[model samples]
Structures are given as structure tokens and as C-alpha cells.
Target: MAWYHSYFKGLPQVAWKLHQDEEYTDFEVDFLRDVLELKKGNQVLDILSGYGRHALPLAEAGCKMTCIDISAEYCDELSNAKTKRKLPVEVLCGDVLETDFGQGKFDAAYCLGNSLSFFPRADMLRFFTKIAGSVKPGGHVALHTENLAESILPNFQARNWMPVGDDIYYLAENEYRPEEGCIEAQQTFISGSEKVTHTVYQYIYTLAEISAMLESVGLKVVGTFGNLEADPFVLGDEQLYLVAVRK
Candidate 1:
């Protein structure tokens, strides 16, 4: 898994070709700007903030941003971006699972793009413990995860890839094994004249499981939406977006 290990090491250019799509970025930005209700003067922490794609813009909007990541490469890249834009952002290289931060440090916290899928239950518990300790009392945390009830992966052969920019492409091809609760996929990217690929294995979680995780960390699931727009969720049509309040 050295390739997976290198995920934070500057994104291998192929990742940009694979994932830096307008649809993908637009979807995320809409959520951050609209669903998360990002505003000026708010202090926020982004767990697993990838390459400052989300944090940098928030900084530009007059918020102080703290980004923690598992990749040193990404930390450095974020630092470089901070210097370029002079954004008020602090980038830390550490395991999101157990990063130590003082209580009430942030006005809000967020984890997006199904990053938790990379961890199993115990590890997710550790991350939540730290996050619960990181946010201020009554602060909020937004978590974005796939709504498996709406996923359309009916068969393994229903795989496809779409290009992003001139180089990157994203592949969402896989099948969910109900009993196993995992979606298996081959994600491929051709970046900067190099080919990068990964066999991505992810566990699917129900809305109930997501709520349970939040409750376990002393957070309450106040809202659950079907998409980034906070629409009434049609369980069989799309992913789940959640907003939880800290107690």
C-alpha cells in the first residue's frame, strides 16, 4: 500500500486529472459555501483537509482555518499555498485519528468526501473523540457521507470514468456487497504523463450508523439531507449530508 501511503505526497498529478473535475469541485464548494454555512470570522478546523482545496477558500473569506492532515506532502503544499495567498490557515501534519487540540478551539469542524470510509469503526471512534474535544461547546460539525440506500451500483460491470480538466479522470465503478457492507473498486488516474491507480475498498454505512457514530461522541444529529442542497432525502436516490450539533 505504498501508493496509498503516498496519497498525501503531492497528489501524483494523476489525482488532479482524476478528481479535479468541475462537477466534483462544484459539488464540494456548494456544500461548504451553502450547506456548511461558511462565514467570516469563524474559526474552523478541517479534518483530512486535502491540499487546501476547501480550507484556502474559507481563509480567503476572512475566516481563520486550521487544517489537519495525514500527509506531510499535503501539509507542505498547503503551507506553500498559504504563503502565496497569505490566507490565515494553519496546516498540521498528523493522524486525524488522534490529533491533540485544546477543547473549544474551533467554532466549527468538518469532515467531507467520505474520508472516514478509509477507517474502520474503532479508528472512527478515535477521530470523533478528538473532534468532540476540539470544537467549542454548542459548536457544530458537518459530515458528508454517501447514502448507500440511494447508490445505483447494481453490478460490478457498471463501471465508468469521466475526465477532469485535461488530465484527471474520476472512476466510480463498483458493486456493494450487502452482507459485507463494502464497495470494491478500481480507481484509475492518468496525471502529468504518469498513470496512478488504486484498488479502493470502502465500507458502506447507513444513515442510522452515521447518527449512532455522532451520538457516541456526544453530538446530536440535528439534520440530515439528501444532497448538498439540504433537500428532503429520497433514500433510494442519493447520498446523505449531515449536520450535527455538539451538546
Candidate 2:
């Protein structure tokens, strides 16, 4: 089974809500405009591009983008965005690890929204190698993911619930595995007359771990920050947006 499809399909409503909220932050847009240093006619790849959050804006910016994602729904969302403006965007539905996109095809690349946190440590290293292989020489890559080192991991199982519009959001429990350096989040959303549950597992990588993984993949960490604004990485920053150059 395709992991991304299964994970995202179960998360449509929340993901849609995250993008739809009026005061929502369009970090993708900020990255394209500010962090990515995108030049005119840059060929870019949005690895795990979800729901056109990053794809549409880059296309509108006159970028020739190859949007890669495993979710058909998200891929269609990109198509719909292009149709809305009669723009051209190549949206491909496939796995990032298996897709034969050809090495050094893109001028630059980006992976945002904590998309890189889905894999285990070794797979994450492999992911970096794959991304580096896809990037052309002198090109760069911007990766966005949670700063797991700053994440507040509770010591015991705790139940928490909140409301998101019409849905009652609930985290049934969460546990931190210190030895494994991972956090397990089990959650459920109750909306109207239905309830759906899903578990989100992620590794809590320290700054050192991330740096090492990049180096192991032959990518040099050019810069590391807490956000798209290039804010200095502080002791408690929750976002890690790393910029790297292919070696």
C-alpha cells in the first residue's frame, strides 16, 4: 500500500482545514517568494506536494514545476488549481523513493509541511540522498519539518481534545519512546455522526541528527533556521526549515 495515500486520505478534512483557515499561514508561498530564492524559469520539484499548497503558487510565479505526490486527491487538487487559471503544471502521482524523475533534472527542490518527518531515521537519510541526486549542481533545496528536538513530549499517556470547526479533535494518547527517539501520537476526529482514528508516528531528531543525515547524503547544510524568515534557530523553535546545497 502507498503510505502517503493512506495517511493523507485519512487526513483530508484536517489538511483542508489547515489550508482553508482565513488566518492560515501560507508558509509555502513565503518560502517560494522569500526563502527559495526562486529565479525566473526555474525547474523545481515539490516532493510530496500536497493539495496544491505549494504547487499552485509556484506555477503562478512562472515556475516550471514538477509536483510529485502519492495522493491522487492532492494531485487532482493541483490540476484543479491549474485549471482555475489555465496554467501549466506537471503533477505526477508516485512515490518519492521510487519515482524515476531522472537525476539532476530540477534546478531546485522543496519539501515542506513536515513531510520529511514521516520516515524512520535510515529512510530519512535515504530520502536526503534521493533528493540530492535529483538536484542539479549549484542548485539548492529547502526542507521543512517539525523541529522534533523542540517538541514537548509528555512523559505519560495523556488524553487531549479540541474543536476544529464542526469536528471534535481528539488525541487519544501520546507516548515518547526515549530509547527509540520517536513519538507516537494516536488521535481521532469526531464530526457530526462519524468518528475516524489515525496514528501519526514521527522521529524526534535533534539538530545534530539532521545535520549528520544531510552530510551522510552528500548534501551540505548551507543554512538552518526555525522558519521561512531565516530566524535564528533558538532553544525552543518548533519549526526547522533547513536549506542545503548539493555537493
Candidate 3:
């Protein structure tokens, strides 16, 4: 099984819940709204929509939302929330690569929270092709990631430890393979007396490579930003937020 198939459950989920910040989500949603030129009745797709952080807010604002995620646990939570709120949101739980997003179905789509780095070259190309095909001509797609080659390589750390929430302590030991253009990481989460470890991989791509891939899929690169505030993307900016329009 892929590392992500099991990595996002249990303790990692708990850590993610604690890491949630409403302010940050609002900022990102605002950025998405502006970049995508979203309207109240527009249909939007949230790829790998973990727990509906951005999906929920966008749905509340009256956009129709279709969220696809791999984690059943997160999907259940999002479904229950949607039920309670009576939002126009549809939740689909499965591997994104295998799921059909449908052609020309959405006005806009987004893959956020560094989820774009999960796939290697070939799979990444397939994923972008799916996104390109899913949106209508002139529709927009937004991608967010912190694993860009320029950003990560300049600040590469072999090992790092940080606190997650109040009780969980997290550590990551990373090994960068230049030949494969990926980072293999062993991540450990410790809370109270319980501890768990998982291995994850994030494929790195240069900005030029990413632009080329999107172009190859018939998506033209439109805007690139370093943050939600619309700052220009600079080398070592730590985040890449790219917007593209389908041709």
C-alpha cells in the first residue's frame, strides 16, 4: 500500500485537527475565491479535501462544492458537518488517481495543503491531466505546495522536531534523493504515552517543471504567489501557490 493510504489516520488525524487554524483557512479561501473568480452558483472541486477546511467555508458562501478525499474518517466528519449545515457539498471517498472527476464539470478546482507533492512524475502528470480535463475551458485550477525544489533544497534539514497541538510531539527525519527528485521522510507522532511512526514521500519539482507540466495538460500558468496575500513567488519563499487556466 502507498504510505499515504495509512499515514493520514489515527494519531496523524488527531495532530491535524489540533493544527487547524480558522484564520489561515479563511485567508486561503479568500485567495481561492479571488484567483478562481468564483461566484455564488459556481461549481467547485476540492481535490484531496482533507476534512473540508476550505470546502466547508466555500460551500457556506453558496458555491456548489464537490470534495474528493482518501480518508474515510475525514470524509465522515465532513459529511456530518455538511448534513448539519445543509450545505451544497458532495463528499467522495477514494484514491484520487483512480476516481473520475468528470470532464468539463467544474468552474474551478483546487488542491491545497501541500497535497500536490504526493505524486511522482508520471502520476503527477496523470493527476494534472485529470484536473485539466475536469474543468471547463477558461476555468481555473489552483495548486499549493511547500515542497518545491527551490524552496526545500535551500533549507534542507536532515532531521527536525516540533510540537503538534498541546500534547503531541512530532519529529521528521528526511532523506532527499536527488536522482529520484523526492524526499523520503520518517515521521513520528507522540502523545501522552502513545507513539506511532510512518514513512512518507514527497516528490519535488522546480517551478519551471511544474509550469511545463501544466502547460502540457492544456492549462496555462496564470499567476504564481508565495502566500495568501498575493506576494510574488521568490526563490526560497517556502510556499508555492500557482493558478492556471484551462485552455
- Say which candidate scores most in lDDT: 3
Candidate 2: the clashing residue pairs are none
Give me the overall lDDT of model 3: 0.94
Per-prediction TM-score, please?
Answer: 0.81, 0.88, 0.98
A best-first ranking of the candidates according to their TM-score comes to: 3, 2, 1
Please estimate how well model 1 matches the true structure, expressed as its whole-model Cα lDDT: 0.71
Candidate 1, position 120, lDDT? 54
| CA lDDT, every model vs. true structure | 0.71, 0.73, 0.94
The digit string of per-residue lDDT tens for model 3 on 18-111 reads 8878888899999999999999999999999999999999999999999999999999999999999999999999999899878899999999
RMSD to true structure for each model, in Å: 3.3, 2.5, 0.8
lDDT at residue 82 of model 1 (Cα atoms): 99
Per-residue lDDT for 228 in model 1?
67
Q: Candidate 1: how many backbone clashes?
A: 7
Listed per model in order, the count of residue pairs whose N, CA or C atoms clash below 3 Å is: 7, 0, 0
lDDT of 2 by residue, 156-243 (tens): 3356666665555544677777887776777677666767777767677877888888888777888888766678776577777788
Candidate 3: the clashing residue pairs are none
